[model samples]
Target: MPRARSSGSPNLACRSATTNCIRCLPQVEWEAPMADFLKLRDRMVDIHLARRGIRDSRVLQAMRTVPRERFVREGLEDFAYEDSALPIEEEQTISQPYIVAAMAEAAEIQSDDRVLEVGAGSGYAAAVLGQLAGEVFAIERHTALGKLARERIAALGYDNVDIRVGDGTRGLADQAPFDAILVAAGGPDVPAALKQQLAVGGHLVIPVGDPGDQKLCKVTRITESRFEEENLGAVMFVPLIGEQGWQEDGRRAASNHLPGASKSQSLPEMIADAAEDLPGFDDPAFGRLFDRFAGRRVVLLGEASHGTGEFYRARAAITRHLITHHNFTIVAVEADWPDAATIDRYVRHRPHRAGTDKPFQRFPTWMWRNTDIQELIHWMRDHNDMVDDMEARAGFYGLDIYNMSGSIGAVLDYLDRVDPDAAKVARERYGCLTPWQSNPATYGRAALSRGYAECEKAVIDQCRDLLRKRLDYAKDDGDAFLDAAQNARLIASAERYYRIMYYGGAESWNLRDTHMFETLQNLLDARGPDAKAIVWAHNSHIGDARVTDMGAARDELNIGQLCRETFGSDAALIGFGTHTGTVAAATDWDGDMQVKRVNPSRADSYERQFHDSGKSRFLLDLSPERHDALRRRLAEPRLERFIGVIYRPDTELQSHYSQAILPEQFDAFVWFDRTQAVTPLGPEHHRGVPETYPFGE
Candidate 1:
């Protein structure tokens, strides 16, 4: 265990006596004067680096020295140094200390290295890198996170670290050479651009694989033309959304054919197998359905999960593939359009710095800060032919059906001007009736009262009163609002309603219907049908044929239900599988190749014991068939080497929704065979196998 420095001693007296004493003191003493919160953090670092076998001394020292408490919300100070990850604004997470240490060690940062990190959440990792390396360049996609990171980094006096708000997959090419790059999120594959930016001997650490099973991987640039790969281990993270990763809207159909099937086989045999297992094929009329786009323009919708490195690479790959193979003329991203001119100028002229007046000065940092969803602006500006005729021919739009909670007030303000009647209803509902006759109910109140009206009036009156607070640019400021409205109009012209697509099945409302969702939905709805769209919500919404089965085609519905209803045939969906073996790097533990069991839910009986100690209420409920399968496999361990279980919450209600069970959602599970473990189970034995069409292509 790491111990705190002694509270008082001659060494401390000498340390405080002169400034030079501190600079010359042993590196360990730099952590002495930090708050107790940092002391706890240092202790955790010791456990992570020493016990966990993180051999990079630079990484360990950096982890120990950086004050994590300074990077989180003030209220969450106590948990600042905890081993578990914590939620930040915009649903992003500041990764746990151990995970950060592991990622940093994996990158193998050298003393004079320059590092580029994607998803600079909280700037904690960047701060750690600042201490370990010569310079750190970090990018955060979310504007709020970018602003917060800038503030925190400056406050900590980390002059060696620089942050910008931008997409990370489009690596900062202006600063082409980076010794190491660490992508904080999970993406489908390594991004080609990032690979190009890596210095000759540099290493790139990222997580690759589908969402279900991600393997940490390090790609090292051996020579200018050669590269080597090493699979590190397993991890779970949010999707990476950018130009190179998998876009949510792009759908690919996988076909599975049986082995040894003769061409002379009867049509009935093919139909029988197709109905039983294969994914339904697209309608032959698909060519006619999209005939309108032959001479006219085409706009593609790209879905991005902006923070994960894996998703970013996937989005980029998908974009390149679409442009190369599919003749996609115009690509509309989930970025802002107003900043397009600036992006175009940068791409063309390639300014080295923004000068003294601009908020960001460094060219590389500026490029990273402005290229995410914001890059859509640049794309539209450069490709004017795609969006020049919004009302008649083409239009660019953002399909961000979900809302960030903080933007509710802004949405309500916009609604107040655009649709006063709806605004009035919202005000009355939120109980914002006040003395000035303003609407407070717009904020979302279960019930309304006269006080709400008074509050609403007061708010509006205060805004009016503060209108001239800044007289010089007041009219120009008003024009800015007009510009924003124009942008909203453009977004509305293409689609009316914002679709609410959910990853988890509809049975769980969790964060989907919260204030943020409502705010975003209303904002998009305010735009009107050019802006209207069908939400591909979870199965819970569309599974109940009675509720969501309306006459509208291509409207709001569950994907699974939509496929079944549209095709009236079985369709295959691809999911990931996990394999266990030895990783490339070794430390204290032997790097052995063995069957490792992987499961979707990390929680097991051990965690349950802490939650419920007495009678062990929760049992791993297995059906009769499943129990029999387990018994048979247990008898012959060698025959049942690896087990894969498909976890469908809708099918296994008793297993997932029992009184003792936790209501977490998981798509599938994989278990590795160990010395004492046995029994392999297939889809039929699992609770929800029949519901999903499996295509292992």
Candidate 2:
């Protein structure tokens, strides 16, 4: 618990006093004054840190002593003490109080220990550490942020703490052999330099792994040659940028796979050497590897991340080629049916349907609403316009099962236009779900808690009724009837999907993939049996999950697995990967979107294997007929990365990589050494913070 400082005492300075000065005084005795802030700090420690298992007394005291408000931006002072990372200068953030406390505690700071902190964003963590240690040396990569942090630390009267502007990865060599070190950002692994700088018996705390997912590890220097490590659980942080770490320009430093110059090429080296060069996507001749999958009925194109520009552009180029040369008619994506239907109509050159102009409007709108996708959509429409055969025009569709309420609305809208009696029946049936309109998971939980009788029955009844009148509805409008029938089916499936997702296990994963595969089949059936379709989805969803450790652990299967099962020789999966660059992602679910810098791919991962190849862009054909060393190397299991619409570069490793047998997962692969984020339509379209009730500060 924290106690108030004595107001106007020699040890304490009052805001209303003669001078506007703030300082932390070292005093043994003080009279109580301004109890409000003192109580608030104590309360924060009690509820946010202590209750959460942060038991270090020194960390608690330092947290209580530091005025968190003084370190934050002017307007954001009110939120400073809250248990969340607040934005600071240069887009850097002052880490949450609990996190700072946890890291400080993990470091096991002694009263006389000399500490070094990498990435001293706002000097907040250094200040806290300074209270526990005798001296603290903090380094920040951004000059402006470092300067500001220095000024703030000086103002707080931390004479022993030093703030320097330089690359944090390259620890201060001149002041080597520090008693303890704390890295505030994530890295692929512990930087060799930082490890060497730790004194014997000293401790080092760092968040290690990819940017999106990381584990807080505590390393103790056992000897000059050995260090013991312990994982302190998962954490998220910015990238550690420097010569020995992620490059500032977002490109990974050239891989050192060629160490010992005389050594022969490794497996990754062989794969890279054999890869075919790929010109820019804008070139008419891009994606020459598609020539190998010429006769494939289903070509599933996968992206490492949703917002990588090269992934989108390359996929679009391949899709365009398939559409023009191979007569591929349908383009199915991993999205909701109702949302993608809007794009379907637009691409088919059909009259712009009311409310169907804009396609994606979900939490991660940037995934499908970016400039690259917009350009692809326009190309589809232009291509459709030039086609003479109506059946030859490519039609877009979504295969995911995430839209229960939206599909219900679409079904009713179709029914209202086609049959008023059917519409009334649907309204009554779907009325049971209207309460949980915003969240289907809540509906599923409620239904599972008591009973699922009425809701399940109603949705099933609605679907059956819609299907029963399909012929009659088609007599007037075939496309409208088909759309309505699909929507009805989607409602029933979505109910089951949501129910299974809440309950947990492989059932939900299987159910969603099964629905997507079934939907693809339905599209082929409707397209007169000669239909060829292309799929666009994350590599996790598009790659054969059976060949990966992720799928084996979860007993999960994805669309790629189903495609291989059904189409066999006729299906081709092409997966894409990138080494590093910028990405558009949110900090948390529904949090404001930011253009985060992507840390380079892990050296042990497949992306590094590609990066080492030295090609900016390349494609590898994995067909057995090629009989190359690359194909043989790719067949071996290796850690592969995958990023979805929600990317947390700070904690990437835990969120992204999985052991994958590359050759078994995909028939072909696309590699980009570096990539850029997809540009959003506007700031308003970026992620927005979720709504939550605020507790008074």
| Candidate number of the best lDDT | 2
RMSD, one per candidate, in order: 27.4, 14.8
* Candidate 1 lDDT (Cα, 0 to 1): 0.41
Question: lDDT tens string, model 2, 1-697?
Answer: 1242433222111110101111222232323334655766776787668866799998899999988877887655544544656667887777778779998988889999999999998888899889999989999999998888899999989999999988788899998889999998877678888999999999999987655345688999998999999988656577777776676665444431224535335555576667888977777678555777879999999988777888888899999888888889999997889888877777786655555424566667777777777678778888998987777889889887777777887888888888899899889889878877667767766688867647888999888888787678889876677678888878888888766554544676677778888889888887878889999988888889887753654467888999998899899999999999988766544456678787898755678777877778888888777746556545644567766655655445434555677888888899888889888765453335222100001
lDDT tens string, model 1, 1-697?
1222332211211101111111111223333235565666666666435555678778888888888878876555554654556667787778767678888888888888899988898899899989978989998989999999999999989999999888787779988789999998777678888899999999999876555345678999999989899987655566666765445453211122234634342222222222212111122232232222222222121111112122222233333333333443233323233332123333223222222122122211111232232333333334443434332221232222212111223334544655556456544533332221122113222113222224334434433323323243234443323323433332222111111111111221212222212322333333342332212121222121112211111122333233334323222111111122221111111122122222222221212111222221111211124334322211110100111111122211111111111111101111111112121122333344221111100
Query: What stretches of model 2 exceed 4 Å from their correct place?
Result: 1-262, 355-357, 450-453, 683-697
Off by over 4 Å in 1: 1-34, 248-697
Q: Please give the distance, in angstroms, between residue 694's alpha carbon in candidate 2 and its true position after superposition.
A: 37
By summed lDDT, which 10 consecutive residues of candidate 2 come out lowest? 12-21
In terms of lDDT, the poorest run of 10 residues in model 1 is: 636-645
TM-score of each: 0.35, 0.61
Clashes of 2: 11
